[model samples]
Target: MTVRLDHRRVGLDRESLAAAYPSASASGRVVVVVFLHGLVETERSWFHRPRPGKARNGTDFGSRLAEDLAGTPVYVRYNTGRRICDNGRELADLLAELVEGWPVPITEIVLIGHSMGGLVARSAVRQAGDHPTPGLSKVTRLVCLGSPHTGAPLERGVVRVAGILGMFAALAPVARLMALRSDGIKDLARGSLHQDHRAEYGRPVDAGLPAGVRQLFVVATLSRSEGSLWGPLIGDLVVAPSSAGDRTQTADLEWLGGLHHFDLLSHDAVYGVVAEWLRT
Candidate 1:
């Protein structure tokens, strides 16, 4: 489960960095915007079909941000089957390498993540704290879209059902099949950030967001009104709104109704909120 830069699998070597970021090298002290994709997804997921009347090319959020904001947009692709913490550790190292190898100085970094990617970002921040990752100081903001911060009900349900099935010898095979899910998927049961927190699944962890970094939690619901019965119950068809934004009272929160989990990936409304927050 390797994490590479963009779809081209850009390496972190000095030569690759020089080739990939020549323009950034020419620019002075630029902000770096990193986009982290969700579970079972690649960086290409950000490239949605072009919106009508909008630009015909570069339809992804990263592309749009490059045009609107004064920053370098970097899309990271990784294997989703690995544990979140494992990926997070690697990501922290990768970012540190990027900082060390960048052609120009970096002023700040903004992380925008979707679904499981958000959890990975948080874990990366936490892992960065254990060591002196120079790039960690530059992370100024983190944006989570439909992330299961507290936990995801679907994962919990699957675990429960798998347990029940395991009790019956006749259904043990099916139970084992369900348990064969990737470690990354299993981490969603409680949004376990640290390795030690895995045992405390039923209880919520108080691992707060990184200090000095602005945080934004964006939740999407299929219901027209978030206050409706289905809103919290079927949030984005994967994550619960309460779990997604329950981490901090200080972080900015946005609840978008009548949208599913995947919709947040390319939704204009989501981009508007992100752009506005970044601008401020």
Candidate 2:
């Protein structure tokens, strides 16, 4: 019943590029930073996707973040198809395994997630629980960029339609396959996401963020020109800024103006703030 999309497609370029410029395995001396993209986007979208005329969202965010954190080690996650919980669990497991098996010592782990990726990172931290991998405890900061902690109201109609259709899909095979995207969205709506369960998403500060984790929310505010008919009124046209703030009063939230949903990742202004946060 869990939907897992093909991430292998997004990572092909990265793999080939790595092969072309293979570096020594990062010794534990490296500061490990993981970048997670939003839904319906691939890893290639972070670095390769080019807009013929205008500056696209997220295009430069990853590159700039990596460049700014030049001395530190970083990994950008490519998967965008699975349910948020499934992705979070997988990422948590992968990080635990990677850190434990790494050839060198890992000094720190920083998680940076944009939009839905932010929700997944928070969920993954919860999944890490007390049985956390030894080195993972060193994770000092979690940054959520343009994430909808309170859920976006614009997708409400789509969510409703998906729920009705999802009920019928339970009776048919092809229907289930056809409803994958909707189901995934529904799961996000029902799970510990910003839009659906504000309490669950915000509970981390006291119940899940552990002792020393510095939680930061980087909200992107978009203008009316950025979205379509169903675009958000207050957000990056996708997620509203109101939904991006902390409900638990534990996180330090900062608003980054003039960014579209994707611009939060690519724009220099937004990137500057993120880079500064990572350094601190």
Candidate 3:
């Protein structure tokens, strides 16, 4: 993940994928936990020290999740500028290949995605049914952290504001900065999963997740409560709680009182909830 986090290694070839992982136990059953990152972020962002420098906290999602859970932890790194559904389809194939080459027999596949990655994870799971990927049959759980299931209004607003700003002569530079978003971010504007993306790119439909798979949505907020003054206006500084975690699904909800979008990555409360869920 550290290497893949680099801009130079962003387009890693298939040959190098296996090298990213250390060998898992050869005999015992294993579970694969894939951590997909958010928009405009690298795999290293999950660890909280996004830059190339050494980490200060002496703790990270990779190290902590590995210690808390008995499984192989994998960080998925990709070009965030590309179409998310395209990446989703590629990820489905990549994961199947990973299972084929893994040392131990993988008993389960767990997908944890944040923001844009969540849409990719869901789309990948949907697309897998059509192509019949190897490891997909083992998929048992999906955890989406601060995902904008409905849409990412922030990205949408940025797009619109940039378009408006471009008309003005003096604000062209600011417009350029605001308009420097990727197709993946545009996809998040509507929260378009691969299936819906067919309308956008003339792609085919992707549907169905493994039946009875444990699905958990982790929602966070900047304000103390959703009813608070800033809660709906600026949820987690990116996604709304209603979008991150469906309030309707009372049984399947965990509400973190005051956390930003990236806070869920390596926070103790988040890890504890995930650990307990996996244990069950």
Candidate 4:
């Protein structure tokens, strides 16, 4: 019942992954960019891993972002299958631990989350609350790609069926705790991360924004158009442009066209935009 976040194991430790790059000064002002991948995706999805669909591209978004961010301090997180809010809480805890133990004087933290990862990042930021440490005080910027800030309208029967199976599995005590802790119910209730939320839930993290954290929204419009499963609906097949950008008074949202949710991570064009945003 517990959703496994790291499927590939990726051979990287959190300390090493969170570590600033060599060029980054030991003094304050190091920018730690954490890229969170969407549901059913690995950290490899952010850059390059082994993908059955594409032979040339090793994986997807994670590798691509790493490549684009060459020489920059980057950490790619691969945590899929957990509930969105639970993942956010875990992220908050991890950040708290990192900041508490960090040797160097940390300056800035940037969270670039794609699809459901974006929602998770927002939740983490919200949980950081009023007196955020290095996690939020150092957090200068946040970018969300194809995330359904509002709850998405499910495709209907699919998630319901899966929820039933998950319920059966949760009968075991260990799995029951895991299921409850993972935010499985929330995910199921909201359907998949890809569904667009026009009415169901409120903006994913709009209600949970911490005081000083900055926010950005990057949405995908088209995917191949001809043979791709994603149709031209101003969306990444799952989250629409509006849903991705939906926020209350405290957010600064941007609209990026011509990409899918996955492409927002891997595609060079999308990567360039994100890089530019970070630079600004």
Candidate with maximal lDDT: 1
Number of the candidate with higher TM-score, 3 or 4: 3
Give candidates' CA RMSD values in order.
2.3, 6.6, 5.2, 7.4
User: How far off is model 4, as Cα RMSD?
Assistant: 7.4
Q: Per-residue lDDT tens digits of candidate 2, residues 148-240?
A: 665654555454555566776464554455455643354444335322343332132332666777778887775534343433455777776
Q: Evaluate model 1: give its lDDT.
A: 0.80
Better-scoring candidate (lDDT), 2 or 4: 2
TM-score to true structure, per model = 0.92, 0.71, 0.80, 0.67
Candidate of highest TM-score:
1
Estimate the lDDT of model 4. 0.56
How good is model 1 by TM-score?
A: 0.92
**Candidate 2: which stretches are off by over 4 Å?**
1-28, 48-67, 71-73, 76-79, 161-181, 190-207, 224-232
Report the number of clashing residue pairs per model: 0, 8, 0, 14
Candidate 2 weakest ten by summed lDDT: 1-10
Evaluate model 3: give its lDDT: 0.71
lDDT of each: 0.80, 0.59, 0.71, 0.56
* Order by lDDT, highest first: 1, 3, 2, 4
Tens-place lDDT per residue, model 3, 183-233, is: 877778766776455243212223356565667888888787757887877
